[model samples]
Target: MENYSKAVNLLTDADVIIVLAGNKMAKLEGLDLLGKGQFEQDFPKFAQKYDVHSIGDAFDQQISSWSEKWLFWSQLIEQYTNHYQPSEAMMNLLKIIGKKKYFVATSIFGHFFEQAGFNENRIFSVFGDWTLMRCSSGINHGTKDDRQVVQAFLAASKKGQNLADLVPQCSVCGQPMELNLPLNDHFYPDTDANTRFRWFLTGNEEENLVFLELGVDETSPQLFEPVIRLVQQFEPWHLIAADYPQADFPLDIQSKSAGLDADTATLIEQLDKNRDF
Candidate 1:
């Protein structure tokens, strides 16, 4: 109760809030990449052929052809993105951050934040979003929205038609296009959004900023250490981690940080209940 009060106070008094969300947050939002939840039932072909039972394992397998790969990818994307519904925790988070100056830096590539009504400009998807596609010609030919392409493939697939020609090609180099994910060596980060996130940090250096760590774990080391260092550097900055314990943080920022040692849903629900406005 005391910890919840402190978290509420920090959020209420904060001039800006920075959310760092990761894989566990993705799981809470109904996108469990590593779990074996109906993967074989939904995607029997891929499961039998590749001997894979999870999305993460499926991604690691090299499919036989580009068309087959796109077909599989389309099914996954359509199910996750086109059919996605924001979870209760996401709604509570929105209420907790009501009208506050905020930004989201997430490693989840499913575009959950954007779909949940968060400002697109304020989000920096650290690992890139899967809904966009880039040239696979080992060159940065820019990204294009592949949602339409995904829809086309799904439509074709439903009719049992060949998905060979439906595979999207890069307009710039006429090369094959791939999902904007760091699957291999050719993945390019979103530099424009990265610049915006950096500027937001610079602008809020002196403000009473709160770093809300939501389900960040070992998978995304990039989001963890650097944020802690930033909190240590900025005297007015505070950290509220949903998963980490207070004792785990450095002694310097211990006074300003609150590690709730709970799941993201619980923390967000508490914040929503405790928030005065």
Candidate 2:
């Protein structure tokens, strides 16, 4: 009985459902979270000598933003798309979140979301797109000028090596380039991401938030705590948290701990049997 019937019932009652995404979602979307296989494939020379077991995680934990991660991965894609053919895998991941209203933190998946059909408004990307670039200068604070730099960066990335050698530079002010999230103390949230943050705070005004976190793990507390708070405040009848190797939840609800890297489609297929809507 714990199937689509109950899952859909929960969905119908939901007002402002949100998904605080994590790296698993990215991995599902063709980006390697551990920098294991493809990272090796992308740069076999480096992988051959050094252990990249934690390099990707370290970058996110250290010098890079979420967008920066994808941009880096895209560099990998540029290098190996013909040999790797990651498009289908990314496409599959995108299809899953395509219909859901969500907030993303600038993984490559964010771009795939757009490719998969999520509306611009429904998806609030907390980090500026890695697919996008702008000068890291504080001077271009708010202007049409920054977008021009962004466009130029995009255009240059088209030529291929630009992705390999692209260094960030301010258009007008000649500053270093920056990614869109708070990767460090020096990290600054961009204007759009700031606007999205404000919008996300108010996005739940309808106040019907159900978090359908498919693969969220414990790298960041920021994503997890708020949903728990929402669950407590509204007491949303039930919070259905399904994960592969699922984790614990509150006493009020039961979770479907499938296993790590569980087939999300199978879970959804089972959940949708009676979801008819």
Candidate 3:
């Protein structure tokens, strides 16, 4: 209860909120890449052929053909993202942030923040979003919306049509296109969004900002040390980590930070309940 009060107070008094989300938040939003929940049952083909039991394993495997790869990719994307609904915790998070100046830096690439109505400019998807595709030729061919291609594949699949010809190609390089994910060395991060996120950080260096760590775990090493260092540098800055314990934080920022040691949903729910807005 004391921890919840501290978290709520930090949020309420904050002039700006910076949300850092990771794999566990992805799991809450129905895209658990590491877990084996229904992976074999739903994707029996990949399961039987590659012995891949989870989305992570499936992505790590090199499918025999581009046609097979895109078909499987489309199915996974459509299954996880096509009908995505913001979970209760997401909604509660919005209420907690209620008109506050905020920016989101997330490694979850499911387009959840955009779908949940966050300003697109304020979000930096650090891992890149799967809904977009880029050239596979190891060149910076730029990204394009692949929702249409996904839909086309799904439609054709319903009619039992082959999806070989439907595989999207790069218009500039005439090479096959792959998801805008960090699947290989060719994956590119969103530079424009990255710049914006950096600008937001520099712009609010002195403000009473709250860095809300939601489900950030070891999988996203990018979000961990840098954030802690930032908090240590900025005296006015406070950290409210949902998954980390208070003892885990450095001694320097311990007075100004709260490590709730709870799941994202529980922390957000508590904040929502305790907040005045």
Candidate 4:
């Protein structure tokens, strides 16, 4: 109760909000990549062939052909991103940050925030969205939308037809296109969005900023420590995390920060009911 109230006060008082999201937020939105809940049931062949019981394992498995890889990726993307629905937490997030200056930095590649009506320009996907594709030429040619190819693959699955001919090719080098995820060292993040996120932080340095952490765990160390360092450096910046305990926060910012030690969904639900927003 104490931490929740502290979080509410921090959120209400802030003029700007910076969301640091991780895999737990993805699970809340129905994209549990590392879970075994539906992976084996949904993809039995990959499970049996490669002993891969999770989407994370499947992604790491080196499928024999590009066609098979695209097929697997398309099905996953279709089930997650194409047919995604916003969760209660996502709705309450909008209410909490309503009409306020906000930016989202997420490790989830499912495009959940953008689908939930958050401004795409203000989002930086550190891991990259799977809805797009990049050239496989081992060079940074650029990214292209894979949604159209995904639709074709889905349609082919229904008719039991081979759509290998429809595999996307790079317009620049005529090589096969791969998912834009950071599966290899050649992955290139969206520079424009990165620049926008940096600019947002620079502009809000003097504002009352709430560094909101959602579902962040050990998997995304980059989003975790740097945010805590930022809160420590800026007097007006407060930290609100759904996972950590209040005792874990630095002494200097403890009064201004709150660690609810709760999941994203539960925290957002409480915040939604307590405040009119």
Candidate 5:
């Protein structure tokens, strides 16, 4: 835990905090897509019909009707995103960042950062958020907030109302709309957010910044090496990872990086302790 002190010092001295969060962070907040224990219990019909035993498998299996699809999506979005509460770790992260210029690049698509009070413009959800939907026509028709759709379906399902007509469709091409996830080849990312992330890096190229990697693993491989490359490229940009050991980094940048080999919650908890807010 000696490095916990190092992390605190970095946070205190940094002008910018760049968060690279991944699925392990999502798991800490209770949205485990690959979890085997809860899928059948939470979604019996999906288990029975498709023999899918996890959320990942359920999303992979095609539902026979749009009604089923939308209903399933509604339940998931409501549980994970719409009704999400910030975890203690998230609050601690906010406190550590402390109004400093920060940008989040995360593969967690549950709207956790935004719901936790991070500015939407500074966060990029790389895998796409389920709270947003897009046209399924393999063409970019823009994204829409799917909160209204989720609410409508939740209300109808409670009353046993028909959901066929309730399924959202593209306003332009009239095709069925789907969650803004990279579930298929047709998935389109939030370009505006991507642009903003790029701009943040460019603008802060020479500033004292900490690139904090939280619970990143193979699920979000894109976040790892590229960030290390950035640390190698920029002298003022230090790297910190919750799950990676400090010795794992390249020899040259190892002095500027700290790999804690800990989980997100533990790191944030450590960062939160004995810190002035």
Candidate 6:
């Protein structure tokens, strides 16, 4: 609680609270941020591969056979980072929140931003979202997104093929589909598709913004580095961290090392109360 004062003071006026949570947090709260309902669909042998025992060992021992690491992480799940999300208690704490930019960027498919109700411009997830599925073929023939298409993709995966390629073909052109994520050499973003629909949203960097981090270990500090640099420029911006008993606060910026476990509900609640979140 060394600099809780600065963090609390800044949060009082923050326009947005960017959340960096992971799949573990999503699963704990009974939310579908990772599109868990379609987990097995996208990854055919997902559950069978990571059974209860193996999964427990992986997390407990940090041991992954070279094969499991590559096959499961490489071709199957393409991600550039490693992170575990915050629990539902964290989510409930955030849902009551509204303000600046709640960028929910996560290594696990990066849906935390949208999950917390932030706009595309405000939030950015490096890993693409499962909410969107691309076809392997091409834009026209490969996009089998609806329930029926996911089912077909699952069936195709069972036979040993990519879900993106398995999507039902385009009726007219008749071609394969691909997942929306940047799968191979040729991939592009849809300019016309706007999830915002039509809403007036705007913000300035000078405005209050809190990089509220919870349960985020030091494994991958890249995501927080940008904000850390920004604090040097805009000293008023808040960089609050609620890590476990073992976390080490940076020497420069102020941080709170609450050694308590991940529940974080009590600590966050306390911070919010003192800070007026």
lDDT by residue (1-277, candidate 4, tens digit) is 9889878888888899999999999999998878896998888987998899999888888988887888888899999998999998998898889998999999999999999999999899999999889999989999988999998888887898886787899999999999999998879989988999999999999999998899988888898888888888988899999989998888988898899998999889878778754
Per-residue lDDT over 218-246 for candidate 6, one digit per residue giving the tens place of the 0 to 100 score: 43365555655665566545555555332
lDDT of 1 at 11: 92
Clashes of 6: 19
lDDT of 2 by residue, 139-183 (tens): 444322233344444466566544434455556776656544445
Candidate 1 per-residue lDDT, tens place, 88-166, comes to 9998898788888999999999999999999999999999999999998989999999999899998998999988999
Winner of 3 and 4 under lDDT? 3
Which is superior by TM-score, 1 or 4?
A: 1
Off by over 4 Å in 4: none
Q: Write down the lDDT of every candidate, Cα atoms only.
A: 0.92, 0.49, 0.91, 0.90, 0.89, 0.46
- Clashes found in each candidate (C-alpha, N, C closer than 3 A): 0, 6, 0, 0, 0, 19
Question: Which residue pairs in model 5 clash with each other?
Answer: none
User: What are the per-model C-alpha RMSD values against the true structure?
Assistant: 0.9, 6.2, 1.0, 1.1, 1.2, 9.0
How well does each candidate superpose onto the true structure, as a TM-score? 0.98, 0.65, 0.98, 0.97, 0.97, 0.53
Deviating ranges (above 4 Å) for candidate 2: 1-5, 46-74, 77-110, 136-168, 181-184, 190-194, 197-208, 235-238, 244-247, 252-265
Prediction 5 TM-score vs. true: 0.97
Better of 2 and 5 by lDDT: 5
